[model samples]
Target: MTDITASPAGYDIHNPSITEADNLLGQYIPIHYHFQMLEDQARMTGFKAALNYLLADGGKVLDMGAGTGVLSFLAAQKATKVYSVERQADLVECANALLTENGCGDKVELVQGDARQYLPPEPVDVVVCEMLHSALLREKQLEVIESFKQRYREKFGGTLPIFIPNASILAVEPVSADFCFQGYHAPIAFFEDPGSLSTRYLSMGETKPYAILEYQADNAIELSFDGLLSINENGCFNALRFITKNILAMNLEQGSTIDWMNMNLILPIKHPIDAKAGDQFQVRFKYDAGGEISSLINAIEVIKA
Candidate 1:
């Protein structure tokens, strides 16, 4: 086993130069991004199935941050009425056209406004908001849900609507990965899609859950984790892998859960720790739920034991 006192200087594991955080903060996302999101079959399939199950009894639904109105349309299939709120003007226009083309304009109402501030004229039975990002970073999913909950309580004075993708579990694991591609070495934080062939997990440490997010309940914006990870393999611990499991819906009778695609985030560490099977490490990390990845990079700390 080897002990590491501190992370090496000059290595920015979070990659401050990356503009994804900035891009996500913009008022309106580009169309190309929406196209990519629409192409995600796993994400679409999970949400559609969840909504179909939830709205089968015929209820009203509020779709916040409804990009392209896909979820709204799905909800309109069984929902008596659907309110789709979107802040982006372009997407709103696109959604309006889509609503007309689909011939469900009477059932789905498209409203242009900020999802965090928008409210339905009457109470809704279900709420669908999909502003998800890896590790809940660079997106306002938590903020929007919290805001809606507070406003709903003040207005309706009762239980809030059922939220789609009601909970999320965040986990982390230490890993060894190759950061070089075709002789170019850029060891930066990146997202590995499910079934990706790039990164290799180190079997030395177990993947540990650090955070749990429940949408309907009040949650802390800032999250911190301090724990010891036992290393069981002799290998290079060069990066930390963050995984988010989105629980879209659960059926108590059947004991089944519908989940969206898992987001795998790989963030390289400044220094690689070479350790034996019996080594251990005290790992500490903290980040805001809707904050940029750069802030998370600055808050990570690990001490060898």
Candidate 2:
């Protein structure tokens, strides 16, 4: 049990109350609509799973990147003790508020520091985290969890809860040309061709928040994104027919609908083009190797010989 008044980092607290925490824990708490739309419904489900994977007596649980401590709250139901690791400062306060308001202040420990460095007093039986960002952006989920896993394996054995990554894949057509074209000419041309620099592009500073918002799953080993792309006469590309290879953590029967998140980008002088959001589109995933042509797809429909 932690002292509600312990002045380690000086509470750094806002208001240790439920109602306050609910309003404050905004950034990480995925909206109900978006959470339902996600491929991994496991956040809530996985919390329960962690208990099953850990000690039946609910020894101890660690929710790394446990923004707002929602998962920790879930684990607190089962765990005799729970430790939440949050990197964000404000979020740490919000989580504390929630825990205190809920009367779980004694059972939960909120640490405001990098999980990578903040070591637990002892090895925990279950380490739960959802650091994964869309297609490995804005997050180093794998690296973070892998570090925890290795540490646990070294101290204990292979008692890690997250055994697989299960990276998923999904394809969709652009609703608008927002993802494609930069400036008058496609600015990405710099990476592929010269002279196109004259076309130029918006600097990273002149961009908006980019994140993965869609979800898909994959059972196959390879996926290809070779379709009509949105490129201006100037030379930038968008609305990529997203195909992924060596994608991680997938388990399903062939021809299954995989969940994935679409990346969002912002740029300046974007081209005005036609790409209705609800355009007819298809996504496919496959397991292939050696750059072989044996595997290909027009959409969800696979090409068979």
Candidate 3:
């Protein structure tokens, strides 16, 4: 139950102009992620989970950060219409094409603009933006969606459709040779400038209950990052934490704070004794706000090759 604010406090994206976020995240997003996001199924989960809350007649929804408009098409199934907004250039093309292929193009609209900058053509009952990342570090989840929510209210008086983020903590033994800095680095302990380090965030880990803070809003620039350490059976290290906060509807405005949540992997990394290959280990995980999570069992059982 560590306060993420104590881990690695960063910046509020809402306070900064769109141009600022463009400088900080624009390049990294497309280069490091957006393409994979279009092809990966993980991005679709939030949208699918969102379907459960969709109103049978909620008309004209907005899918902010609609990487491939998957959520938009999905929402179109339940609602009368949907607008999928994506900031990345090529992604808009992909989402547009996907909409057509899915046969929902008639009801789904695609826009290649920042969700924070654009408003729906008409007022929407639901504003779906799954810009969330592991432990709320890697994406502009809080800011963009909040901004859209504000716009939604200004244009029409209605609550935003920000569903629950519902997140928790998972502690596990590192999985691969890459996760083991001590054993992999072996005789040489110093790093050669974080090269080839896995940028992967948020993986299914052991289950345990933790009291981590949750945040959501209609508009604001809120973003942050944090890293924790862990060890494998042969002694390795890696980051271990993710976000799960519930986002209710909002009419919030500018100047909100994005508290960065961080979890430090203490057991395997800190223990004085080195774990040998094939050692049996258990990673305990916990979550808050009645959220459900499933993680890789081998994550807690780090076996040396």
TM-score of model 2 vs. true structure? 0.46
Instruction: Give residue 159's error in model 1 in angstroms.
Output: 1.1
Model 1: which residue pairs collide? none
lDDT of 3: 0.46
Evaluated with TM-score, which candidate comes out highest?
Answer: 1
Ranking by lDDT: 1, 3, 2
Question: What range of 10 consecutive residues in model 3 has the weakest lDDT sum?
Answer: 187-196
lDDT of 3 at 47: 42
TM-score for every candidate vs. truth? 0.88, 0.46, 0.52
lDDT of each residue in 184-289, candidate 2, tens digit only: 4342211111112222232211111112222122122232332332222332223222222112233345543222232322222223333332233232334222
Candidate 3 runs further than 4 Å off: 1-27, 30-46, 162-183, 186-305
After superposition on all C-alphas, the RMSD of every candidate to the true structure, in Å, is 10.6, 13.7, 13.9
Residues forming the 10-long window of minimal summed lDDT in candidate 2 = 202-211
Which digits, one per residue and each the tens of the lDDT, describe model 1 over residues 1-305? 22222222212334343244323433235545776788888998999999987775679999998787888888988898999998755567677777767768799989978777889999999999898888888778888888899999999986888899889889888777777779988778877875563535444577899988889889888888899887777888878888888989989999999998566888887788887777888889998887888777778888996
